[model samples]
Target: MDGATQFAVSALINILTSLICITLSWWVLQNVRLDLFLRNPGGIQGKMLQVLLSIVLGHGLAVFFIDYLGWSGMIGQLF
Candidate 1:
């Protein structure tokens, strides 16, 4: 494929991966007991915190996965 097509495909994969990871993180976070650390776990601030945490954690995971895939793909160059 051309450079533009490859770039577009990569962008789409990144977006989908990020979104999937974010959703997975949010789902996993639901099991945590936020009340232990927050005075109002049900309040807007608490919800916002949850969202932020999910995004951070998810993005971190996504980065790791992307980097791993890239590195693995380069392994054949060693031959």
Candidate 2:
């Protein structure tokens, strides 16, 4: 493919990965009861923690998915 086509495909892949990561993180946060470990689950600190956890988890999962699909090397090769 040409450079423009390759760039478009790469952009789409990135967007899809981000969407998957957000969905997975949101599902976990909504279904899991975090009160088990947190002192105040609904407090500001707890919410901040939740956001941090979600971002970390999402990034990890996204990386895992990309690696599992053998796209990690492709990304490195592309850029």
Candidate 3:
């Protein structure tokens, strides 16, 4: 594939991975008991906090996976 095509594919993969991870994180976070830490877990602020945490955690996880895949692919160069 050409450079542009490769770039597009990589971009698509990164976006999809980030979105999937974010969704997974959001779903998993629903089980956490935020009431223990928050005065009102059902309030808007609490919900915002959950969303922010989900994005941060999901992005971190996505970066890790993407980096791991890239590094593993590079292993072939060692031969």
C-alpha displacement of 36 in model 3, angstroms? 0.4
- TM-scores for candidates 1 onward, in order: 0.96, 0.70, 0.97
Query: Scored by CA lDDT, what does every candidate get?
Result: 0.95, 0.83, 0.96
| Model 2: how far residue 38 lies from native, Å | 1.5
Candidate 2 Cα errors over 4 Å, as ranges: 71-79
* lDDT by residue for model 2 (1-79), tens: 9999988997788779967896789779887788999999999998888888888888888878767766656677886
State the local distance difference test value for candidate 1: 0.95
Q: Which portions of model 3 show Cα errors greater than 4 Å?
A: none
Where does candidate 1 stray beyond 4 Å?
Answer: none
Compared with the true structure, the alpha-carbon lDDT of candidate 3 equals 0.96
Candidate 3 lowest-lDDT run of ten? 69-78
Kindly list the per-residue Cα lDDT of model 1 for residues 30-77, writing each as its tens digit. Answer: 999999999999999999999999999999999999889789979978
TM-score of structure candidate 2: 0.70
Top model number, TM-score: 3
